[model samples]
Target: MIKLIGVALIAAGFALRVNTLLVVLAAGLATGFAAGFSLNEIMAMIGKYFTDNRAMTLPIVLMLPVVGLLERYGLKERAEVLIRRSKAATAGRVILLYTAVRQISISLGVSIGGHAGAVRPLVAPMAEAAARGRGGELSAASVVSIRAHAAAGENIGNFFGEDIFIAVGAILLMKGFFEAQGMNVSVWAMALWGIPTAFIAFAAMWWRCQMLDRRIERTAADNAKAGGVQ
Candidate 1:
């Protein structure tokens, strides 16, 4: 339907790699107009919503500049250099450590970084350098695998860890849901239970990381064998 033009625009914008903020704004305006809102009414609604949600948006808006400043100052390079100098920093260990960092920071209600804001720019690069340490260049497949693990580490850490923060949305949502179902559940209890789950999740990921290390080694060996045969 023509009413879905806004959705189409959003999809196309993303597919075409347009400016994200502009794409969002355009989608909003188009949707509002398609739904019979006048220009002034839509403008007023946008202004009011923006004012009300500024707190949530502020961090994301400010994050770009801060991340940009750090990148400009060689944060990625510094991370690589530090890890490369550490002989014990294997690819799996590096990712596990990053997962630990992510979980700890998120549990404390501090969001350090994410895949978009951190992984691609910082974590992946540091991991690549660490994994490549004293081993010459890695195969393309090996490099992709390391980056994938870096991204997964961020996801596992943040999702599990944030539930441990008492005031986070998950605790509040669970509390509300339980109350709605005529059951009593306290936020503290919910947070306490989250700790065990987070711990278990961390342990599972740790085991997986160790497995990943073995897999990478096997891949490297096979690649070397193939090259030698050639």
Candidate 2:
């Protein structure tokens, strides 16, 4: 039972808004001690696991500098300019399009879109440009809302779409977990089940995007009215 102290520590640390890395390390040390492991053994286990999964961190390390360079060279401005050229584009429509593309690409096991790599530099700016092209100046709050919607679209698309690829890490993880529990679930079946979930996620996000557009329009109107009153 003392082995579960780690979970309690994690909950308390998060609730208290402690530094995440420190909280996790403290929990790990507490759990190791409770389980009668020496500090050196715990450190070795932690190092081994980190080394085994080190590949996962490589993409972020490689992607950040590349994204930074592109942004420095006007990637965001170009995205905004390109989006503004479309007369029919709205912020909602722009996000909906990116969500669809993200889902489709990730379903094929292509690691294309992410918050830092795509949403921040490309999608958010494009959506904001689309909103501005709608002929009203956006309030600071509206701008923040548009960026939030952009990030949400990426998250929804990635979360639902990755499971559709049978070879993806998430599907494999589920297969391993179920097999350990003696359920004998197949990878193909898990991937198949994800299709309907992906569709549902898309539908829900589509509705939310439409609501975002309406909200933007309302904010614009309110701002216009306030200007007139002053």
Candidate 3:
């Protein structure tokens, strides 16, 4: 029963909305102490874990500084400028392209496609700029719609594309499950099949974005007419 103190700590920390990193570390330490480990042993275990995974986390650590530097120096403005000049590019189209880029990048193990790191600072603002250029002006609702579409694109693309990588955890789990059931499955087969599925999903999402663009344009036109009539 006392062994569950670690889990309890996690629940309490989360419920209290404490700093997540501190909470998790505290929970682990508490759990280790409760489970009969000395403080030194617990500290050693934590160090060992980080050591074992050092290479894996190094890239993430490197990316944080790089992303921060970009934001500090106006990467968002650069992204907006790049998107605004393309006459045929709408908010939805710009984001859709970002979705594709993010998916491909994520499949290769780079995860710069997140909401805070990529979407908000780069993708969303560029999308807003693109839309405002097309329609001459943008309402708050239009801005929200553009950002929402960018977020949705990042989410959907990342969700479906990552599983296609043979070395990804999900495909490995699938391989293990099939083998346990006395059926043979190959990782290569999963990767091969995932390509077409990803393409289909991307096309479907692209079509939906196009529809949203049309709807936003119509709403803008309707609002204009109503204002003129008043």
Candidate 4:
């Protein structure tokens, strides 16, 4: 069916690395046209859909100014200082703890830890600063690596942990899908089983953070020795 034109547009757009918003809009237009809707009618549909969703998003947009104000006053620096002063908290350790906390929070229905909200202004900078403090001094490569790892930890923790919550959309979807196949299952059962999987993922990422810290230390020492020779 020409209805599938939207799907083709999406696939092509992604394969060509088009801007996501643009691609989605284009796909929507194509689908609307294929379904016998005029361009103006399609525009109206888009307007109505956005109007419904916009109310839900107003709170997030409103909070951004508050977060931006905090960043202007040195939120990242404060986070670094707080972590450094705490003996048991390395930057990596702090991020690991945050990963656990963020994941658990998402499972608890607070999905606030995302790129715009948490990663850019707080977690990444704090992790980088922590890495630099403990590893003597970080090179550009090390800084990027530490930032990447911090992001990876957040993503992994959220993805694997959120399924452990009965109220999460994924668990509800799973329940629907299984029941459709005549297999009755409860969301609570699915969530309870997800706990062990979340723990395993957490431990694996924590181990990686430990290894990265060790490697950073070794690299810093090597750089120091090389500098001494010069």
Which of candidates 3 and 4 is the stronger one according to TM-score?
Answer: 4
Score each candidate by Cα lDDT.
0.81, 0.84, 0.78, 0.78
Worst ten in a row by lDDT for model 1: 52-61
Per-residue C-alpha lDDT of model 3 across residues 69-130, encoded as one tens digit per residue: 87689875675576556664687788888888778877776565579877887788777777
| Model 4 lDDT tens row, 43-99 | 999997676445345645776788678768977567556645655446678678778
Cα lDDT tens digits for candidate 1, 3-79:
89889999999999999899989999999999999999999998986775444445547677877788789875776
Candidate 3 positional error at 117, Å: 6.0
Q: Count clashes in each candidate, considering only residues at least 3 apart in sequence or on different chains.
A: 0, 0, 0, 0
Candidate 1: count the clashes.
0
Q: Which of the predicted structures, 2 or 4, would earn the higher lDDT when compared with the native?
A: 2
Candidate 3, residue 66: Cα displacement in angstroms equals: 9.4
The candidate that achieves the highest lDDT relative to the unseen native structure = 2
- How much lDDT does candidate 1 score? 0.81
Q: Considering only N, C-alpha and C atoms within 3 Å, which residue pairs clash in candidate 1? A: none
Better of 2 and 3 by TM-score: 2
| Candidate order, lDDT descending | 2, 1, 4, 3
Residue 72's C-alpha lDDT in candidate 1?
A: 87
Instruction: Enumerate residue pairs that collide in model 2.
Output: none
